[model samples]
Target: MASFHLEEDEIEKGEETMGSEPEVDEDPSSSSATWGPPHQHGRRRVNNYSGGAVGLNINEAPHVNKDSTPFCVFMLYFARIIRLLVEETNRYYHQYLDELQDGPSPRPDMTDSEMFLFLGIIIQMGHDIRDRLKDYWSTAEQFAMPFYSNTMKRDRFLHILRFLHFADNNTETDRNADSYDRLWKIQTIFNTLNDAYEKYYNPSKHLAIDEIIVKFKGRVVFRQYIPKKHKRFGIKIFKICDATGYTYDMKVYLGKDRTRADQDVTATHATVRGLCRCIEGVGHKLYMDYFFSSPDLFEELMTKDITCCGTVRPNRKGLPDDFRRRQFRLKKGDIRVRVRWNFTALVWKDKRDVYILTNMHCPPAEGSFCDEHGNAIKPAIVADYNKHMGYVNKADRMANSYSISRRTWKWTNKLFFHFLDMTILNSFILLSSCDAKLSHREFHLALVRNMLEHAARGPPRPQRSRGRPPAVSSAISRLEEASRHHWPTSSTSRLRCRVLFV
Candidate 1:
């Protein structure tokens, strides 16, 4: 091998003398013992040849100064938004507690206040936080974005308080933070959200129920209860989403105990009933999955004048196959009575062939209404019911197909993160309610495109000086002048482009 070593003095002298010569490529066959070139191979070089003060004597210099600004101003704005929301929520919660208990300030230290506030904000904003980010940050921030919303935040805070035994274990509990416990804080956020749904949205006839699974830190091993199927730990989240996609109610059923009794079915039912009581109407509907279906529970809902719609399992033997076929019959107006549907079937539990059970009865309408594919449809309500059932079946299938490992925190975070992702999807649904012209999925796509465009068109940076820096006022003046010349023309061009695209 050829001797490649060079003295420090020789290298410095070579740099000085060879300054004017074109920079040579790094040697390709350097031994593995040597570090790779400082820069990547086959890359263009940045020439900072402007040696004099305030002027470039040569033609080339680095394209832009790296330190002038953050890579994403959009992300900064989102962080600011998260901060603002947390501060505001804490203010409201503390105020509410103050009125009820006649107490002094809940949390005194500013740092403690901020940390809990962040926890509350993340859970309350659950998934909705991601929506705000979709319009600003790239996919990286989206992945890191917290699962929180106004309701979930409050719920988590309360759950933490309950776990610490700082307050009464009731819906209207007012206990605040006692100490700094991380897991307590996390659990409180979820539990409080569940209570909020019971208090505000559950009783109303307009609420619907869904379940979410939140992964945890370690494997759930149980001696008394049924050990969780996968070693991975998770909390089963029961959410009551209103027609608008906002969570009115929730329950964080710890997944460690898989026994039928420990699942807290009674508490979950009571919470659902509590939510239903909030709505001021004679007839309301509560949508659920097959897991919640029971003879007594269905009868209880019927007695309360609240209708329940969900999948009835195959082995549910009270109603026969012949009865189901007869019940599926359609009728015409005047002669047609609004009979409840008894949707129970033994077909495979997949997206394409899942069954829906409802108490409402109706005559099937075939030709009057058509699906998107122009196929003759059943009654409009029946079609809607079918779509909803299809979505639940699909979600269940997707959840089953995927499994997370328990070996790392990254895996745990990833599972919970995916569960929180529904908040963005739900927000898109809410936006669609405001403007019927767009679907939630379509709105998300548009926002993503806009965000990418903004990121690619990164902000311009200020130039660095060799000697004394320019005065602040002088720099401001230059920026103002640039703006005056640039903004109006840019705005007009953008408008023209939008018009053409439309």
Candidate 2:
């Protein structure tokens, strides 16, 4: 319940007074201030406590170009992943058709090449599938041809949609399962992409964990209503991303069962633990929002050699009573610091109280920032958290900007397209990290172009040359001779007589 206040005199003196206090716990097991050995030699250490900067600097980060071909970076990383999805989809589609009893094949079967084109069309044309298909069939433009072949009809594409499934039919199992348990439909695909994501890139320090909502109004039991979100109703996904918006890991939120408890684990703690499981013992520092930050979670991360930083809600358990109490007397730049056995909680009063919790940072000797008025101060931990916490949000914004997802009655289809968008977004992040100088739109365009070009059957045909019309040699000679020989009496009659004679 105790808290230590930082006075203006102490701030002006630039003294490190918080470390001297007995309340600041020095337990090696719980304190994140203590340094540990590097996770691996030559591994780039993310912001460490010596006031090291967090996240990547755009100018100084390493440049790695895996392939020189346009969109080769995307293909190199995601080609196999896409192929797997297509194969699974086709397998399930055929199985579904064969199982049908009443109708004459519920839908037509699709080939891998056709499926690739379908996805490419989605990337190239961000519209309703039917409208895009209509345009593809009706337009005279060359760009439209690569997206949908001249031979392909709109009905065929619709058939593909009708039969698309990521998993096999198991009505018995599905019917017996809970309504929220339908995530098994696409679980394999999700696992495949996740594995590829982690294996392809090693995340830098300063990772962020946050939720992403894929907007949907479909009939589903697990549909969430987050009024604050732009799309209030959708399926929720928890994501852990790095500084450049590269998703290192993700977990779909099904319901309360998404978190499994061993003893006294909270949902927030369990979610963080699940997302960060792969990166444990690697000395990575994770940043999250108040929803996931807690004293016990920070302690848990510290044990695994990971550092944690985030804003904490005041009402959360384990927050000191003094820290929680409303402060009307505190000025704009006033600060408070409370160091527990496991984590440090900082309260800086700017326009309002901004509370920060971290196992990675300690109280600053001199608060490192000034507001526009030059009178208000900001904490370094606050600044650092603000800088890195937006990575997941950045990923979300980029994905949603030119989303290829369409309005669908089926939540599963919406979820599938959402996955596709995330896949492309992740590829963009990876490519940009490797020094590919392209925006998200450019990356997607290049991917579409590459896929279409590669799948093309043959080179485009050449246009035939148009030569001059055959010369009227005989007629010209006759006309010249007639003109030389004849000076007619009546001009019109003479011309007619000369023509007849010629």
Candidate 3:
């Protein structure tokens, strides 16, 4: 794709055109009707559907229970996914034992049913594994009764945790090096979940792409430290999410650029492009941050019928020189536009200099808003970018609120918990989309309860604490005698008195 710098004449024409249009107050609900700039005389036509096309049609969309009970929802939407995890886990467990040269031990191997129970307990534990396991084994109370399983002891559960593998060991070495190099142990499971994510639901037209940090402060080659993120050190994942925080696609960022062959393009552009490959030619509008925005990227996405709007860094290449130099000189609410054949860049003065680049929206014919001081106006593209770029942040906040993941030395294990968190988040999104009124906490609690009830026999009765039962008969006799003796004397004295002994 070719990129061009905006000339003086084009800038003048854009300003004159913007100034001549009549200003009309717009309602928030009608924002989608004028999402992008109006079609210009010589620009290529872009699709601006009010509600973007669905990824899957109604007939092809995954069926979710509209009126099922909570338990039924668990069975239909969640049980099978957990079952798959249990099966894969058990297979890997036995394979590890068989490979041991010391031969089979006296302990029996874990069954699929037992693995299911183990996972259910872990989900409800939400604490350090060792501490939680000790409590489950030692506590003698009604609250802990449901999690106790007679078939699986603490040692056995620990064994499963230590050797919990998602993919076959033999085939791990032979796996594709490009995508599965560092994360080979869990790559198969990751791919499986990714497939399910895309197949189950189609997101709306407006999508946001952003990076999420999975907390992992371990000795790993690919660990990242993003100072601005809440978790400063962890694995970074690039995600494409819809307006409702549904993750449509994701790509884990491994250390260096092993997958991409092009060296000239920055990794940010490559990550955005790769995550967007699925929605290409679908006329979906993408909103992003400064890290992933560039004129070249917008130009390339235009070819794929994808329109992008994002804040551009002033230092980024291809921005007009005058806009960069004179940005500080413009008064608040002052707006300037520079247009090429296919690309448009807007420089608006808000609190500071704000640069936005897009191919979808033209210079707004009339849309503008005043600041708090009524001194400056804001462009329509800036408004739209602010509206749609928050989905990824919302998702991150939701996932982190009730994260079940624990601290671990192994990055893969940390990542496994991250996936579990994502699964719960996705399930909440799915349930809410089906018009269910359950909150995130409610959905999770229901799933945990239903899974335990379905997978295990009713909670084992609490074992009574070992001690002699208290002899209450003697105390009862003494209390009765004392009351009888005091009743007569207290009646005549006009004073009420009673005695009890225990």
Candidate 2 lDDT over residue span 218-320, tens digit each: 8888787866556779898999988777787998877666325464777668778989887786578788777777777887777777888877777666666
TM-scores for every predicted model = 0.36, 0.72, 0.72
- Sort by lDDT, top down from the best: 2, 3, 1
- The C-alpha RMSD in Å for every predicted model, in order, reads 33.2, 18.9, 18.9
Computed on alpha carbons, the lDDT of every model, listed in order, comes to 0.37, 0.65, 0.64
Per-residue error (Å), model 2, residue 348: 1.5
Considering every candidate listed, which one attains the maximal lDDT? 2
Candidate 2 local accuracy as lDDT? 0.65
RMSD of 1: 33.2
Worst 10 residues of 2 by lDDT: 13-22
Number of colliding residue pairs in each model: 43, 0, 5
1 versus 2: better lDDT goes to: 2
Mark the regions of model 2 whose C-alpha exceeds 4 Å error after superposition.
1-64, 68-72, 75-88, 91-108, 127-151, 171-181, 325-329, 365-375, 457-502
User: Model 1, range 150-188, lDDT digits (tens) per residue?
Assistant: 212343444333222222223243233343222332344
Task: Name model 3 segments beyond 4 Å from true.
Answer: 1-63, 68-106, 126-133, 136-156, 174-180, 324-328, 364-376, 457-502
Off by over 4 Å in 1: 1-187, 196-206, 215-217, 221-234, 255-282, 321-355, 363-381, 387-502
Model 2 per-residue lDDT at 77: 47
